[model samples]
Target chain A: MKLYLGVAKDIVVKRTIDRRDQKRVLGNLYDYDVVIKYEIENFKDQPVILDLAESMRALRSEIGVNNQRDVEWELVADSTLTDKLDEKKSTADQAVFHVSLPLRGKDDKAVKQTHTIHLRIKNEW
Target chain B: MKLNGILTLTLALLATMPTAAKNVDLSTIPPRDTVQLTIYNSEDLTLVRETRTVTFKKGVNPLQFSWANTLIDPSSVDLRFKTHAGELELLDTTFPHDKPQMLYWAVRSEMDGDAELEVTYFTSGISWSADYVCISDPAEELMSFDGFVRITNNSGEDYADAQVRMVVGTINLVEKVRELAQRGLVSRDEAKDYERSRRKAGAFKADAKNELLSKLRADFAMAENAARQPKKIVKEGLSEYFIFSVEGTETMKNGWSKRMRLFQGHNVPFRIQYRYRPQEYGEQLVRMFLLRNDTVSRLGSTPLPDGVVRLYRDNGRDGLSFSIEQQIKYVPIGQEIELNLGRDPEVIHEWVSIRSWRNAFWFRRHGASVYYAPGKGHRIKINDAVVGWDEHQAWVERIRNYRDKPIDLQIRRSFDGHVVFRSNLEPSLNDYRSPQLTAQVEAGEKKELRYELVFHQGHNQKQTNVTLESVN
Candidate 1:
């Protein structure tokens, strides 16, 4: 039996905010907050264990178009839902991440930049 | 001594007869009257339907069906009454606890008589594949094509006098039939629950079952009708499935294979061309024989299945010379089939880089600053660092055809990274990254193709794709 999570329809990029003004700000580092909402469901008869950390590793974020700027992002340790799902049950959860865009120049503007986030679900046996 | 011999004979007869134990009367299954096999090549699955006459007593009659050493999925086993549907009822089917590969069905009969029962199940290890042979005449303009299908049976059971059909499309299977066949047997309650869930989810469609049975019946009728004629394959299209039903019955023994002719086309006309796709066929020119799977080519009766095609040429001296053997995918009606005969030594293709130079230099005032931005003009500074430039490259391609006949040739070249392609051959963009050139060379002629490319480097590069420009 396989679990169908409907990843395409269940995942949404909630919001992206420029968090450079937050406390503990660094001079050379640009920070942004990206929130995502997702739902995982087990529609089969067998129970499946979903490794949240492993799944979070597959999340990708890119800033700008054509010539893209390098950005690093990771799950914020907290705000992770359960790692396992029971049969015939669904869980709606939110994941928050901090994207660090390195400042290439003083005039570099990272705000309101066209960005894309891709999420893929990988099965772990 | 006569009385002793009679007693021994009676004992032997009693031992051979079916015995009733614990109110369950065990009866051996009778020989099949007619059997049909529908084999799907994409998957190791065959749907088998066979009929047999079984004598059932009034009340509950236990019939034993065993699939010992056979790759028959026990979960897919089904029993239906073909002759006395209204008079017989299947109470329940039970897999014996001690027996690993055996099952019993408790059938209730309204009246005691002989009734024909149909047993249908899915099995693995029986498969069919298709191949073709093409023989070209001395002129190479016309050819004869013949298709054949080879069916191999390794299912641990022999199917005698069975009609065979091959499906040319893929079907979705959640689980492999081989795995299920080796899964032993699940508990009756669990099996029922699984079946109920599957039905509720509509995973098992009733229409599909009906279609299968209808196709089998039609094939059986066609087989009977074509009994007197020479062996032929009748083609039918059922939704997305294309079936080739082999006429007449075949006795397929275990671990045996049989090849049957599918179709033959005589004097099918075709054309030949030479292609040079550097990205696909490496750096060599390949000869191709082209034909369409339509009536003009004498083959449009049905879609051609995927197969290996062997090409031979008639040497005009009462002998045939082998040319090439290529594998082709399934071709629908009216679709062209292109057979690649590999590199031809008679045609020589040479690609040479004539010259390369760098020009259009741009200088930057400050280090790591923009040197040449698009839509911006820059002046040369005395001590400025060189930060960008454009590189020019020229290439010459030559093709020499030594054949007696004129040859048609096509060449494709791919480039990347802000490239401007200028060629006198009037090349066109096959895609954003590749330029294509076509030419017709006369007999014993050599053609030269010249093209120049300019690649933008550093800040001069604005795009990452090739730009095609024609030059006289």
Candidate 2:
């Protein structure tokens, strides 16, 4: 059987504030965060090593649907899972990633998500 | 002209016949003599009026008008005798329960002859929009401006050989015309109530309509004489609405759009300036072209409607370069029009902080419940904690203009907290928190502006505002 990798429908996305530092500098860029909890299903008969490097690159355009002039998004490199997924998993695993966003002025405090992210899998080999 | 299957009229001579009779003597459908469409841009509404001549016998004549598959408001259908108003009487009107999208007008004629009848109704799915094209000379001192109006028709009816007029004002409506049109026909009781209310307001409408018709006739006469020339849009001001009547008749089919030139002007004088409004245009210096909407700019005959403006510049080599495309709001007469052309690479602006320091410390004594500034007739305690201080900072701004001509520049900077701004150049307070500076730079010249700011922090802050002061 060939390897099958598909995006799960139980993904969650939210807009939050960055809390990595105790003292946030005034006028600091990237003060907000877009947290995404995504899951991938693998149903291949044999165990397959899913390379996390190529998958991370494909997720850039999928998460940038809500980008605007004042509000932007960029994936955090260190927070992504660098491990591989095992085959024949029945929706038992998930991964989370953080995207840095920016905010300015008093009126930009209540930014809402206006679009949804739809992800699809592209099989290689 | 033919009615194009959009409107159908059937006349029944009901002499000595019962009201419930089904079969009657029916006359042939008559062609429309003239039609006029008055479209309002602020709403999805169009007032259509058509006139046709019909031969009526010296008895009761029932006329049926049907608008199937059209966006015509049934409640707004009205009929009036244009030629024999005194001789013909509209006895009653009806909307049959079996038939939809139609109405009947019973006319009792006293004489046998040809009488011209006018039918009017309101409709939806027709709208008009205005847009402009501006071409500037290489020197950027003059431009050619052309305005156009595009009319879109989607009302499921074709208007052939019709006079079109567009209105440029907003009117209040209790309900949308499209909603009423989509609701199909109303019941007999509701139709009677609507007709009664319309009759009560007929006097005011008649006066307004008469004024509009008189002006339109004068415009039409002028257009007829200039038939050999290019098409011209005749403009008139009526009450609060501005009307633009297009010359000649147009055949507007469904799902089609027609564009007509409204006006054109050449050699319209304009000026250019560079502005540095960080809050509005981010952190870059933007170039702008400014002009007035008055006679000096050759465009003050009427107010300009809100529309998109596409700007292009002559490259002085028999070619044009696209500059910018932007949307502008409605510009009244004598109002200035500012077009921002974004950032220019020829002009550069830089801001740098050169120095910073702190002084004027305020200390709060431990267990003393009092804070005092240094050297205020109080003995200083080494154990006292420093609670407040004043921070001083200096900044230098530079602007380089590389264009072949002189340029005027204005810069605005905003500061927060209790602050005092001191500068070598004269500065004015744009608001409570921002200071504005204006200067002129010659071509190939670089100018620098210096200013210092003092921020009072913690217990030393007296108020939260910026005060501008000139330094000798």
Candidate 3:
């Protein structure tokens, strides 16, 4: 049994509407990290962030395993890998499309089931 | 002398040969050293001054042209030609108004074919135009751009002490706009620009500085009067949009009372750029205003310097957006640049006002008619005898599902002349902005009874005794 995945397709980070940068609230929700390269087996079980997925359930950050451990990852529900009905958004010449998960795997017969497939992708502007 | 006087002089020489071919150059006032480009001896023109445009084709042109010593004092000048490949190299006996002059050429070409061209110079009057005016309200985060640039120097050439800067981009980003449209320097070809960016004394620096309009003005005036206008601010780019306001999503800034006329420009020489999406706590305040007055005189070609204008911010609803690329600095040559820019102090309120009520029925501005008429039928009767309104703030609510709702009412009838009635008023009042609907009309003088209108008509016949509460 073997599997793996890697990604870093298109990356855009241009801004001009700021609300006091560094922010993070809990219950009322307000957490913004823009884009950084942390890793936790590439977002545990990927596919979250559908325009923030109805106010969010879970999608923590701070990853760095092989480069020497720096964990603090969290992902609640993995979404089989996006395209839950295709449709991209374009606003006044700017662009956006996001997704990312660095690896994948699936196996059955070790007495039954063993699956762990991850993913990652991003298209921003 | 007799063939009908030669057919009336051949129809007057065929209408004077098309009025002399449409009055070729008509009055002829352009000539200060007219006829400038003469590249006969010095072949291969590489770069001719006067800004640009002097390219030769054909294998080995190598030209160096100049006439009457070449301005500044070339014994005035005079030269002309329609087509010349004979390459004379130079010619201009003498002709000069002498104040404004520009004659240059540093020829160098490895020619290929049509290596011939001629130009007659003389400028005492040359002014062209396109001007400019872009006014979009998108509900006013504010953008009412304006334009106009006119400079006619007659070619006698008198540029005293010059300093002009007007290049907003496009056409490859503004190239001195074809030398201000060739000395005539007129603007308005819909903000002309195919690609142009010139810097001699240089005036363009933006790595990401800051300044759209520090202070610059030639003449500015807003609000033609829709009750004084100026309230149309509905923005939605809060990073995702929602700058200036967002409580439930700020929205007002509508039509400023609908007087709609603004966006004006005259004589020409203007610059107006506006953008708003502030109300930021972190960072997002883009502001710029320079309505010109020119400050010290020469008036409007280009002069407004004060400095500081940097724009670029993005938040695209958290994934984080940032791309600030706006620049405008040093604008005080003549003077006029207003600034209120973005605002992110949390903003108490950005703007909001939405009241809906347009044409209420029951008309009569000059009453006394029986059923509205000068012609007789179309049924009309508005005595307005029982006008009401004094003490009643009503609201008949109840409608989560009354089963039907599609009402239409444009009532006015004494007989059947203009009456419209569609059923389904069923929505009693689901939170009607706080109950405020009163109706009561009693002519006996209780006075404040409000209003009431009752009319009946039927063409159904047979047992026609229908009064189901007057059809709701």
Candidate 4:
């Protein structure tokens, strides 16, 4: 089983190539890049942060390996979004992210996974 | 050849008829021309009679009747071609083998035309009850009573422009109407029992009808001798039962209730009294409105069905105000009905004097010196063994009349145990059954009734046995 630390989604870019023998090179390819943009908050300790960063690097290497398009990733930790999530958790409210999944094609390229998490805290003290 | 063509045309017309030998479409039955409901309130039974016009063929006509999803008792269905009975003859009725809820009727008509058919059957879940409202005068001696009949229909059927009749009596129903309607759900033994009971009910119905017919004939003979008058309610006596036919037709929809005025009597004579029965009602002085159901008292033609009767008192205004509103029970015909109107706070009665005394003829326990005998040195031995003891109780009841007019206050004072009583106030009718005192008190008058009661203890106080001699 391949271990993944973050959600992977497809990013599609439609292009018209002007290369010499572009027609022979199959310009209208329906492939997509496996891009990952992950946000994590309130790590609680340094070990949790280190483990999450290491999982992210492992996820990047394993994803889009047997595919045509190249894979990319970006991680935003302890940002304003994470601070807002922490504030909502302290005030006993719900904090969640709304994410749409990517569509997959028959090409032996990008495979994606999506995950959603909801957090609620009863009291701050 | 033309005659054969005419015969072929007639055969084709008969074959093409849509309603022949098939499930009757409900829409083809046509609207009811007249409908009547005879509701027996004692049982959850209503006999419905409906008349509708149907077109029949020249020779044989098959008519289908279906009552699906309704609470109609299929066994009691009866149909008759009321009009054109001589021309339209009912041959036979057959229940289809496949459809459980439909029955077909074969009628032979001499000529093809429109004929009216009357269908009657018994259905459950329709009920009616009588209610009354009475307003008393200031003196509480006269009242105005209004009786209303409330009819409720929940038999899953709608009855429009139906003439309603209410029966008032005990109808002995062994099996419930709903059970009979769903007879297939019952066991075979239960169905046998139901059949026996249904036969009994049929016999009772026939007897009641015969009695009613004889009574009506007698009444008609009596009517010729007496003055003929218009009766608002067409009441008929069915031996042990009485039925009242309401005047106008009413539209009774499914799951709906409607109340109509049955009768109203003005200046009905009544009496207001106070009663106190400690053994029954506990320290409350219940006020009662008493009335007689007779012609002299303004109400007596039929036996009143068991229902609610409300009473109200006018608050000295001409036709404007009323107080002391209370609901009571139904008053049967020709009987004196007593309606309790709760407690009376105005004309109050309380214990003003209470005196209890021990009779000197019997000895009672009095402290430690009870066994001491004079000159006998504690060997207190009487010639005859002490039999029993007696206690006499006395009381003086005071009643203050606060009403502006004189009121006849009847008081009933009951005791918990047996007592021999005598009073200064003369009981209207003195008997061992129920002794009561009646007093006519003027306005703002305070009257007192003194009475004495002697309680007896039995003589068999001890059984003779051998005693140990001075063991202590």
Which candidate leads the pack in DockQ?
A: 2
What C-alpha lDDT values do all the predictions have?
Answer: 0.66, 0.69, 0.23, 0.55
| Clash pairs, model 1 backbone | none
Best by TM-score: 1
- Residues B283-394 of candidate 2: C-alpha lDDT, one tens digit per residue: 8999999989899899877778888899999999999999999898887779998889999999989875544545676777878879866646655465666667677776
Q: Indicate the worst ten consecutive residues by lDDT in candidate 3 chain A.
A: A116-125
Interface DockQ of each model: 0.01, 0.01, 0.01, 0.00
Give the per-residue lDDT digits (tens) of candidate 2, residues A1-125: 37776762222233222222222211111133333333332332222333222232223233332221111122344433322222212111122323222232254332222222222211100
Q: For model 2, name the residue pairs that clash.
A: none
Q: Tell me, what's the RMSD of every candidate?
A: 23.7, 17.3, 29.9, 33.3
DockQ class, candidate 2? incorrect
Kindly list the per-residue Cα lDDT of model 4 for residues B1-472, writing each as its tens digit.
Answer: 1111010000112412243335333334456787778787777988777788787668867666666656776666667778899998876655554555556666788887788887877778899988888888876678997888899988877787877778777765555556656653222232222234334445234334334334533443343222222435566675566777766677888888998887888999987767776655577777777888889899986667787777777767676343444444555679887787667778878763244443323222333324332223333232322224344555567888897877776666544334555665665433343456777889999888777655554332232221111111
Model 4, range A56-120, lDDT digits (tens) per residue? 22332343223221122221352323332332112111123332333343453333432222111
Q: How far is A81's C-alpha from truth in model 2 (Å)? A: 45
Cα lDDT, model 4, residue A8: 24
lDDT of 4: 0.55
Error of 1 at A2 (Å): 65
User: What is residue B166's positional error in candidate 4, in angstroms?
Assistant: 1.5
Higher DockQ: candidate 2 or 4?
A: 2
Interface RMSD of each: 22.4, 22.9, 26.4, 53.2
Best to worst by lDDT, what's the order? 2, 1, 4, 3
Off by over 4 Å in 3: A1-125, B1-302, B305-324, B327-334, B338-345, B348-360, B364-472
